[model samples]
Target: MFISFEGIDGSGKSTQARLLAEMLRLQGHDVVLTREPGGSPGAEEIRRLVLEGDPDRWSAETEILLFTAARRDHMERTVLPALAAGKIVITDRFADSTRMYQGLSRGDLRGIVDQLHGLMIGREPDLTFVIDMDPAKGLARAKGRNGHEERFEDFGEGLQSRMREGFLALAREFSGRCRVVDGDRAPEVVAEEIAEIARKSLAWTQKA
Candidate 1:
């Protein structure tokens, strides 16, 4: 089964992704934990370009292409192979990030985003956890992090707020595969909730 965790910056999506992978590993499942736009070697190179730079480094349309290219590389080199081997794949983020981030930064571009995804990367995770939290609180948490990947987090609280709404909308739009998890609690609490959701989702996917 494949699972993804997503949310605005500092919503603990990465941490929960890692924790869920670890928990599944402890349960004796072969679990592969990865993230985009840097899962494969080639994708990692693209990741550096997209994540670490001036915010306006690429035109919004150009940025979309870069992200789609990275995702294609990641799926071909990492995601598809692992899934073929019957392993659990958990990722920190996925195509939904593009839908939200690009839509926010470049104006309404959902049509183009969906078209590019449908044309190139044509699969969705069996389950997705959107760690819902307040934008201001999420920004405060992200503030402590230091890295070149600060581009998205640097969008400030205003953008983060909009992205939060976008994610919630997406969760509803993809209700069959997405779950919104409250992210205001302790990490342990959040991890437990996600693990349980993954457990149920995994069972359902396997049965199907």
Candidate 2:
């Protein structure tokens, strides 16, 4: 099963992803827990350049391309191989993130983004969990944990709002495969809900 967790920063998507992977592992299922833009070595390097460098140094289109480049490396090296072995792959973020951050929020080179999506992960996640939350609150939670924010992390209110809208748009477009969970709830509750959703989705996918 290929599953992904998507949401704005500090929305607890990563935490839930880890928990879900652990739960599946406990069930005697092989699970690979990873994150995008840095899953593989080459992708990690690209991630550093994209996230830590001067924000003004790269244009929006450049930013989009960099993300897709990292994604290509990640999919070829990590994601596909694991899935081919019939293991559950849980990713913290994926191409949908690029569509939200660069395409909708930054309005960059979206044509290339779409092209890469088609060429790369033509088969989307068997199930996608979008942890929905208010952007301001999410940012605050993120800052609380990390102490400081990075370039993309500090998008401020305007960009954050747009990103939220972008996520919703993507969810609607892929309704059959996407599920939204309330991220404002307690962590344990969120995790339980996600686990149930994953179990049900896996069952349905297998039967189909």
Candidate 3:
């Protein structure tokens, strides 16, 4: 099974993703927990370029291509091999990030993003957990972190709010594979809910 966690930065999706991976591991599942735009080595190098520097370091178009390249490398080197080994792959972010950041955030480049994804990286997670939360709270949580990856977080609350809406719209558009989990509650409570969903998804997949 391949799963992804999505939402505005600091929605605690990353934490939830780790928790879920650990839970699955403890349950004796062969699980791979990873993140993008940096899973494989080649992708990690690209990640530094895209996640740091000035907001205008690269034009929106250039950034999209870079992300696509990284994703392709990740799929070829890391994700595919693990899936072939029958491991449960849980990623912190995926192509959906580009759809929101480059396609929806910057402008109406969603067509380009989708076309690129279809052409180069044509796979979606079996399940995507969107940790929905208030933009203000999410931004506050993001601001508490210090990292070179602050580029997207630096986009500030307005962009994050729009991003939240975009993700929700996407969840609706791909309702079969996306689930929205309210993230304002305690982490333990949120994790429990996600675990339940994960259990059901695992069972369903096994039956199929």
lDDT of 1: 0.90
**Ranking, TM-score, top scorer first:** 3, 1, 2
Candidate 2 lDDT tens digits, 1-208: 9999999987899999999998999989999999987899999989888777455767778888788889888988999999999999999998888888787676655667788779765757889999999999988887677632267776676777778888888899999889999999999999999999999888887899
Best by lDDT: 3
Candidate 3 on 71-188: residue-level lDDT in tens?
A: 9999999999999999999999999999999998988999999999999999999999999999999999988887778888887899999999999999999999999999999999
lDDT order of candidates, top first: 3, 1, 2
Give the distance in Å from residue 138's predicted Cα in candidate 3 to where it truly belongs.
0.7
Q: By TM-score, who's the top model here?
A: 3
| lDDT measured at residue 135 in model 3 versus the true structure, 0 to 100 | 97
Q: On residues 1-208, what C-alpha lDDT tens digit does candidate 1 reach at each position?
A: 9898899998989899999999999989999999988899999999999998777787778888999999999999999999999998899899999999985556888889899999999999889999999999999888788666888777688889999999999999999989999999999999999889888877777799
Candidate 1: 10-residue stretch with minimal lDDT? 146-155
Better of 1 and 3 by lDDT: 3
lDDT of 3: 0.95
Cα lDDT computed for each candidate against the true fold:
0.90, 0.85, 0.95
Question: Which pairs in model 2 have colliding backbones?
Answer: none
